[model samples]
Target: MTSAKALLLLLILVNQQLLTADAELISLTTGAIGAGAVGAFSAIFGTYSYIKCKFNECCDDNWIPGNVAHKLQQEVDEKLYGQHIAQETVIRAVRAHVSKLKPSKALVMSFHGWTGSGKNFVAKMIAKSVFKKEMLSKYVHLFVATLHFPHPEEVEKYKEQLRSWIHGNLTLCDRSLFIFDEMDKMPYQLSIFLFLSNGGMNAIVEKTLENYHSGQSREAITYKEMEQLIKNSAFNEGEGGLKTSRLISRHLIDYFVPFLPLERRHVIMCFKDYLRSRGFPTNADEIEELASQLHFFPKSSPIYSVSGCKQVEQKVDFLYSDYVHEHYKKHFIDDL
Candidate 1:
């Protein structure tokens, strides 16, 4: 049993003993001392009950036990652009997992995509929907491969520590969300434990282009088509952590959600979205200019964004620094 459970048992036994003693004392001498003893026991038991309730309710502020599916769907639809496959897969998987009274295993999703293709964005959305404090919540843990486990020589040591950290956190809050970014950079050994990025970029792009040329909507792409492609690429190509990892072999990962590369129109949408977020007017000309700054892929076709919307916010801010400052200053002065 856990330390908390042991402490609770101890408290229960002590309270029982105190209750028995108080009853005998009250029966023996109906005096001030007996009445005082009875009052003290009652107070102790009440304190114990309060402590128990607090322990149980400690995670309430961070975790919402309600239907997270609707909230997640709404957030994804509104904020996340492109990658229709990722949007649908995540919602259905999360809904099925969360709605269960007791899941057979933890919900493990491996996100595969090129940089700025909304892997991190979708992950954040999931965290925001499930966690009240989002990324700031204690229960939401994010581990970047390059930062957390950089040294390949220390793989064994990292493995032990990683296991302990995950186990301890789950003990505290089983509903915890763990996001491992840059899985492509992690040592193959560590990928056996957790699953991230750049594992299926080519497949995603090629398939997307194929769909477009076939006159199918981007949303028409199905999870079934992407799943096998992503799994194969993650397992076979590159020196990515997922390559030959037991997590893939044992099939521990629940889903390999693919985030497709963004097109010119999607990049323009991102530009407008960023501008709106900063309280700036989304002028047609300005939006077009901002979108123009980003480099797209396939020099022949030039259809998909090379960096997607990754640098959009920074680029917008850098280009319109003076305007942003003036807008904010005007607002501040008006308020005054």
Candidate 2:
């Protein structure tokens, strides 16, 4: 080959190599630039998914589950209103539901009324009798939100925060319960009224953690609120931190609800005691006398309970036909 021809071939080869390098660089650049968007996408999607799943059905919107509602209904049937029998029934049913490998939403069953009517004491008794691990394990993964003294502002703040966290962090679950005690105090609570009535609403647990953990804000929820949150949201659905929580929260609840199945999760809530506690009784009743009449003991003076349909039918019949609206609005309506 002549020198000129050889030089021409070398030039052609160098040009080919340059072209290859340019193509490779372009590919790398494209990939690099796309990485952040891809990550951001995954992060946002993950966060959204996490939020929806983690809190989709949280606390049955922070109220009693169907099973609990069912039991409460039964109590009402038996005229067990103004009694913790309804709550006890809920505990038993919750336990039954959990034992079946079924998990439930976290909820706050606000026990309210005139101060001193033994509502709180009744709640405690109801918890003891119905919320035993053995009972709740069967159906529910319990979460309790007992307010020490939830003022209206505090209630709204927590509710807004909770809704934000759920939207940003939580996911839907088949079943959970959030028992909000003293909701009457926080007249502006979300998901609570709907809960007792068995309706759907939203809450967000992820934003709650993010605002809290990143020092963007304090873990603003106080000890009482936190305890209730932990208890209610005992079955958290994420690895940790804001990002992961956001990613997994929504899907977590969604994932759980399907496998768990709510067909069997009928619930009810009951109101038996007409007051808060003996010391805080409604009306001008003598403390000791009112407490005595209220049956502060586990076993009632009448021995056998107002058993079965007779008791239930009577109470419900009256509430539904007689004065159900007034009953809830006036008698059972929590003072918060």
Candidate 3:
């Protein structure tokens, strides 16, 4: 019947759509798989033209293409930096962060900053291009930046399992970098993180002494302890979190609360619009001086404004947005 033929055609179309979506998902996760027998299959798909099945060629589609992994490799190889500052900066970062490291052991460098500053995009490009090349791969061990969560309710891990992970890298016996992308969001930057990322053990020195209080815990943390803490504090949901049947809860903010340093407080104010609301300091001070120095911060706006910590805590959207709009307007708006 004509009706039966139409139904069959519709079903076939639906199946093809599902297959396409499945393929996309696999591409997105190719960089996150474990290597084993299954990993062997992944490698074949990623690197080899298995369809050239040697003597065992068959009707099977062994010549299937790889996902984003393949595409990324091609992009890195084909990328031609045409006298752009961003490309130069990326190359500088690669040279400064990787090439300069001592060949004694593997190193890591966490490029911490706000979101949408192209951390992952830039990181992937560097790893795929610099580390995969024959000359650098011979001595400079490179890797994709890894993220670890520390406690419950947070996404990254603590210092618990970090040591063993580093110990595993010991066998490679070459200087390398394990870059951490976001450090300000973490409870505190671990010492080992600096050691692994920076190549030198003492790279964990404070960039600003103002952050440390007189009586803060000064004991150094070990890699194992950090990793163990991460493993213990896992998130668990017990039957839709018990909030007594008819109970209600509301969160409140304290006005003009005094905490943290005066400079830090001002930074938050400038960030949230509170500074503009309070008619931001007309008498120029150190904050303005430093803002100009930091590339991460935007160029001073004629119409400067800010908000409170409560409004934009853990969300550096404005800063990242301002930076992206200035530099990568066309690419920034595209759907990732």
Count backbone clashes in candidate 3: 35
Q: How do the residues 122-164 of candidate 3 rate in per-residue lDDT, one tens digit apiece?
A: 4555444433332233323233224354343542344334555
Write down the worst ten-residue block by lDDT for model 1. 185-194
Q: What value of lDDT does candidate 2 attain over all alpha carbons? A: 0.32
lDDT of 1 by residue, 152-271 (tens): 788789888988988888777677788888766543111112256787788888988899889999988899988988877766775654665777678788898888999888888888
Task: Give per-model CA RMSD.
Answer: 6.9, 24.5, 19.4
Q: Which stretches of candidate 3 lie over 4 Å from their true place?
A: 1-86, 96-114, 131-147, 150-157, 172-177, 185-336
Q: Who is ahead in lDDT, 1 or 3? A: 1
**Candidate 2 regions with alpha-carbon error over 4 angstroms:** 1-112, 116-157, 165-174, 184-336
TM-score (C-alpha) between model 2 and the true structure:
0.23
Q: What overall lDDT goes with each candidate model? A: 0.76, 0.32, 0.31
lDDT of each residue in 78-97, candidate 2, tens digit only: 53332232234344444454
Q: What TM-score does each of the candidates earn?
A: 0.80, 0.23, 0.26
How would you order the candidates by TM-score, starting with the best? 1, 3, 2
Report residue 143 deviation for candidate 1 (angstroms): 0.3
